[model samples]
Target: MTTSTQIQRLAIVTGASTGIGRATAVRLAADGFHVLAGVRKRSDGDRIASSRIEPIILDVTNDEHIAALVERVAQDPAGRPLSVLVNNAGVAVNAPVEVLSLDDWRFQFDVSVFGQIALIRALLPTLLSTRGRVLNVTSVGGRVAMANFGAYSAAKFAMEAVSDSLRREVEPFGVAVVKITPGAVSTNLTESGLAAAARVTDTMTPEQRRRYAELSRAFIAQAEGFARDGVSPEHAAAVISKAVNARRPKTRYTIGRDGAMFTFMPRIVSDRLLDAMLRSQNKSLAQEKR
Candidate 1:
């Protein structure tokens, strides 16, 4: 028979204002878990809060907020271990390596890599005590890089590495670290990232722009297309919920068909073949424009 402890779980999800994070927060609450929906803004938090889900203002980049969250988790009356920590907060900046500014690159890293690490470190004590699970929401771009997504891919690659190392480090303590690589989901990230990309592109010298025009357009179009064809955030959230609740979850979970097929399949194929295939796809998109 399942005990009360087994039925009641506490889940903390970062970036819970919208998209995957928001969806996951709602789903976890519905699954009988008390959810701490972390958002950077109070308004965003307010939008996510409900009877089951409680909104908490958390900017992963802010040390003070992270510390507060740790304290709050430590004070839970049930003394039930934190069942899940879903690190779904990330930012994307799309631009060719040459045109991508240091600030833009840093911005992506700050949110996706450094911010995530900061939050994990701050909550390590509580997580260790509880033997909870940590889920890092990476991206397929981490495994396979596209031309214009260099900045974003670099951050995700670092996140993937961090997640893998953390998984090994905490295993002895009964804590599980899972890397969730999502391909494409309908979210504001693409539109916002594309705008940032455009700003970076505008700052490029005429010569640089001329040299990279086609690649730039192709990248923007790809981002837009992905946003359009992306799966629902709810679908992705369900996968995350499973990862948290499963008796024996895998080390890594890939969400979306493209992530499972194209992203994972390239690992088995030759690098040259993969490059050629990507080049062909981009070329086709360019030709369609002309």
Candidate 2:
């Protein structure tokens, strides 16, 4: 028989196969919560190091998987209640709107917006039972849009609205909704985005391809350069852990120096000037090729 003492606080972290999701799950387990680490691949589950973590196969984009996860967490022994849900599973679709396909746009919102909201809805009962918190691991793009990131950033921006709305609604019931926006974190996201962008380029007409050339080149360079300069996933993970344990968590946590700058600077800076700066970045890439 399971005793009350044997039960532990639970945290469900999506995209636990890599980067911030993986780091957060590891850190939470270290901090004494039994983490439900959601990974899409069996091989990834094999890589988690903590005994307190149960690596569950979960793909946020799959409806059946989301339902099954809800059912699985609901079966936790009588005394164990879920304390947190980290919506971290996401894909980046990086391309200018002119070059972006309809399918790519749908996939971006499907994973980061619809799928995440569905999981949260399914898990809300379990969360309310424990008066738990919701942590959305978003990107710096969520706050300030940039060239070639419209699709991905749109989804994150939508998520920011969702986070705010949910935060207000859930707070009266003692549930907190927190958003963690990190900038240029060392992760597989950029590589994945670039891969998707390559496929988009392959499908483009000659004119569209030429039109997007400068933006694509600049995007690739920026992503690669940021990978070298970005903070580690551990930095984001630590903020998440702190948010999880705080008596009164803030509405958002900007995880790095770059994150804080990108998220807040847009509010004070003029839109026209920002657009000029971003356009200049693309021009600089074209100049490099000349």
Candidate 3:
């Protein structure tokens, strides 16, 4: 029989197969919570599992996976109460809105927007019972939409709104919702986004490619720089752990210098000014690459 003292706080972290998710899972475990690290593949699950971190096969977009996760929380073997849900699963499909296919757009929203909401809705009952918190890992693009990040930015912006709405709805009931926006954490996301962009470029017509090829190249170069100069997954994870453990956590947290700038600068700068600044930066980066 599980004793009351044996019960531990439980945290569910999606996208735990790599990067920020993996780091967050490890950090939370070290902080004494039993983390249910969600991964889509068994190999990934095996890779992240540890004494305090159990791996769960969870594709947030899948109804069955979400249901299984809810069931797992409901019947914890150690009677651990659900404490936090980290919605970190996301994909970046960077291509101009005019050139990106509807399928790609759907895929981006499916993973980032719909998937997060699906999991939240499925787990809300248990979370409400435990007065748990929800942490959404949004992006700087959410605040300042870029030239080629239409789909990704749109989804992140939607999540930002959802986080606000949910927070207001659940705050009176003791639940907190926090958003973590990272500037450019050193992760596999850049490589993945570039690959997706390449595919979209291939599908573009000659005229379309002629119009946007140089810009895409610049975007690629800048994205690479962002990854190279960004903070580590461990650093982002540490900040997340701090938020998780804070008695009165802030509604939003920015990970790096760029993260803080992009999050707050948009509030002060005019849209045209931001556009001009981004265009100049992109042009310089493109010229450098050439």
Best by TM-score: 3
For model 1, residues 1-290, the per-residue Cα lDDT tens digits are 23366457688999998899999998888787888899988889878888668888988888888888888888877665687899999887887888888888888899989999998888887788888989999989889988888989999989989998998899899899998889888888888888888788889999998888788767766877878899889999999988988888899888999878755776698988888889988887666555
Residue runs of model 2 more than 4 Å from their true location after superposition: 1-7, 285-290
Ranking by lDDT: 3, 2, 1
lDDT of 2 by residue, 1-290 (tens): 22243237778999999999999998888777888999989999999946788999998878899888888887886456798999999999888888788898999999999989999998998888789999998888998899889999999999999999998888899899999999888888878887888888888899987878787788888887667778899988999988988879998899889899988889888999989987998788656555
Per-residue CA lDDT of candidate 3, range 182-254, in tens? Answer: 9989999888888999888989899998999679879988888978898999999999998998889999999
lDDT of 1: 0.86
Ranking by TM-score: 3, 1, 2
| Clashing residue pairs in candidate 2 (N, C-alpha, C atoms within 3 angstroms) | none
List lDDT for all candidates, in order: 0.86, 0.87, 0.92
Candidate 1: stretches off by over 4 Å: 1-7, 77-80, 288-290
Once superposed on the true structure, which residue ranges of model 3 sit more than 4 Å away at CA? 1-7
